[model samples]
Every structure is written in structure tokens, then in C-alpha cells.
Target: MVSKRLFQSVAEQIAELIDEGAYPPGTRLPGERELAEKLGVSRVTIREAEIALQAVGRLEIKTGSGVYVSERKPASLGALPQASAFEVTEARLMIEAESAALAAHNITDEAIDELETLVNQMSSDDEGVANAADERFHLTIAQASNNAAMVHTIQSLWQMREQIPEVKATYEAVCVHDAKSRTDEHRAIFDALRARDPGAARQAMREHFQRLLESMLEATERKALEEVQLRASQSRERFLAAAKFG
Candidate 1:
């Protein structure tokens, strides 16, 4: 199905192309003038898309040269800054998979202790504190991967979550179920990490983040859309009042 979202459509199209191997990792994309011509969008739109893609670690734009696809596909894609809920999922799928794998090899006693502390911190009597600590726990996991870039990219998701109020609310609500699933997932991931099994660690990370991704995507974005209507009404009122005053 064609995406009704214009910019998102543009981003997804590129993301899919990379996934399908049509764009191929480490290959350079056409220049802005050429891409805009091909994409049938203004160069400005192309520029915006590139930045958005870059934020999520998808495409690397070299001003002196051209835009080139990064060596890592899924991780690179994850590193790109998230522009939407789907993008966040895309990034999580890409980065966290590798994150889990690396954590399996990198886990130290200190890291394990930190994880336990985070589990305790997750119970934030206050939601704001909870979210903050929750993000910190995830960030610590990503950092444990020993990949600086991955850590930075995953951290970016914290800001993206702010824009996604629905995701925050829904996930927070889900955390109420004895918080068993969450603790279990963290324990499973720790088990893998302690064993130094890369594949299992990655798998655990995937399952946990995938649940979150699914829940967020299921949340209808009607609230944000409704705000558009409110803005329109305020704009019209201001215009009419201006005409009457004049």
C-alpha cells in the first residue's frame, strides 16, 4: 500500500531500497539534483529527506562529494535519526539486534550490577522519573555493546520518544502488568550476555524492542492529527478578526 504520509513515504521508500539490496550497502546515491529529478521533489525536499535519513544513520552526506550508503545496513539504518514511530522501530530493529549481540561479548560484572540497578530504577513511583530511568537502562545496554556510534544512535531515540506521546503513554501503561515481562526480558538478555552468546543476546533484545515497536505502531496517531484541525480553526479566527478590525 502507498503511504499517505509524504515525507514518511519518501523515507520508507529509501529504507526499503536499502533493505532490499537495491541500493546496496556502501554505495553512493545519486546527487541531490539528480535525486530530486528522479524523486520528482524539490531539491529542498531531497535535502530534508537526506538529513532525516542521516539522523537515523541511514545515509551519509558528504558535501564535498556526494551521499553514500554506510557500510552497515541495519545498524546504519538504526543510527539514522528517527522521524516517526515506524522509524524508531526500524532503528531499534537494526541497532538493538547488534546491540544484544555485542553485549553478549562485552558484559562485565560492573555492567551486570548496573543492569540490576536500572531494573530497580524502572519503578519510578512517578512516570517521568520512570521514563527517564527506563531510557537510561536501555542506554546503558547499548553502551555495553562497546560501539560508540551505536550508543549515540540509540540515545537519540529518547528525544524521539518525547514527540511520540502515545508511545510513552501506551508503553508505560503496559509496564503495569507486574512488570514481569520487562524484568524477564532483561534477565534473559543478561543470561545471554553472561554466556557470551551473541546470537541469543541479539534475539532477546529483538523480542523486547519488537513488542514495544508493535505496541507503538498500533496506537492511532489521531491526537496529533486532531491538533491540525485545532490550528486551522485558530488561524481562521485570527484572519476574520483582523479583517473586522481593519
Candidate 2:
């Protein structure tokens, strides 16, 4: 069974495609069965995704007819940077590692405690709660850097993470398979910060993203391989967009 947020990710993917003109305004989307097969998800997930897109005015669903892309684009789409998951991850690795190092030196005991709480919260069964806590955990460390510029930069990266459909989908897919690894990595970084070890903190943060990047590659390759016999070009193109990092 998929998490509640999986359909949101699917909705984002459809919206992104519409925005990119793959499905132009007024273009009818494929049937739920086709989309489900293409995305390797349940038909119920496709239905939920379409309903979500319709609710956001990105699509129009007719009772007898099919879902069509809306001509009216979302206002916030233009504000988000056009970046792939790999680019976003790469940026986070470079910027956040330094932020973690600085945070190790500057973080207060209370902030450390807060991070510990967030780390524990990440182990929650509720995906929404765990995801929110994960964001807070990183932001707390970024804030601990005591550098406004660093904090702003980290915030922007996270905005890219959350707002970009492909990035968000890729992350959700990888995260679903590695929740334990993610929590352990966060703990390592938290431990480094608590010890006030800048070098260790930097290394821990780097290791976290490094593992994330590697996992993304593995997931992308695996999915592409699974779908290649059916839609080799399309599957490869989609996964490659998310797996561009070294």
C-alpha cells in the first residue's frame, strides 16, 4: 500500500507534464488504466491523482468524458526554479554540508535537543508527520549555522525539493524504500552536532547526501530496467531526468 502522499506526488507529476506542454491545454489525459500501467501504480492512485489535479484547477474532469489539462496555469509555477532532482541534491550536498559544519560549532543545547526530537519524530509511521519533521530537522541545523545567508540558501533548496514535481517524486520513491537509512543518517549528523565536531558533522552530512544520491541512482536504474521492455525510451528519459548526478 502506498502512503497518502504518493497520490500528491503523482498529481505533481501530471501537473508538471501539463506545464511542460506534454499535455497541452484542453488535451485529454490518457485513461486511468493506461496511466496506472505507465506509472506502475494502482488505478485508484491515478484516480486520486486526477481528482487532486482537478481540485487545484490544473485539470478538468468531465463525468462522461476524460480529464483534460487546464489552460490556466498555477501562479506559483513560474516562481519555482526548473531543476531536476539530481541538481537539487547536488546543491544541498555542497551547501548543507558547510551549514552542518558551522552548525556543529554554533548550535545551542536546546537546538540540539530539538533536532533529537525531530530525529525521533522521523521514525513515526505517519508519512506526513515524518516528512514534516525531516524538513524541520534540516532547517533547525541550517538555523543553527547562525548565518542568515546560509539559512536562506538552504530554504531555497528545500523549496526546490518540495515544489518541483519530478524532484519530489524521485525523493518520495527513494525515501519509501529507505526510511531506516534516512533516520540513521540523520542521527549520525545529529550526533556530530551534539559532540561539537565540525569535521565529523560535515562528513556526516556529506555521507547522508552521498548515500541519497547513490540510492536515487539505484532506484532510477531499477525502475527503468523494469519498464524498458515495455516503454524503453519513455521510462529511461523520465528516470534519467531524476538520476543525473555523479
Q: Judged by TM-score, which candidate is best?
A: 2
Tens digits of per-residue lDDT for model 1 on 1-246?
633535456767777778888787789988769877877875545655665575567876543356778675434322334266666666777887898788778766776776666666566565444444455456667767888778666756654654465544555555664366666776677677767899988898888878766555545355567788899999999999999998
Model 1 weakest 10-residue run by lDDT: 73-82
Candidate 2, residues 1-246, lDDT tens digits: the string is 735578788888887888787899988999989999988887757866775565446776543356788777643433677899999999999999999999999988888887998899889997766776787688778878988678767867876787678999999999999999999999999999999999999999999999999999999899888787669777888899879862
Q: How does candidate 1 fare on TM-score? A: 0.50
Instruction: After superposing candidate 2 on the true structure, give the runs of residues whose Cα lies further than 4 Å from its correct spot.
Output: 1-78, 232-246
lDDT top scorer = 2
TM-scores, in order shown?
A: 0.50, 0.64
- Model 1, stretches more than 4 Å misplaced? 1-82, 163-180, 221-246
lDDT scores of the candidates, listed in order: 0.67, 0.83
TM for candidate 2 is 0.64
lDDT of 1: 0.67
lDDT of 2: 0.83
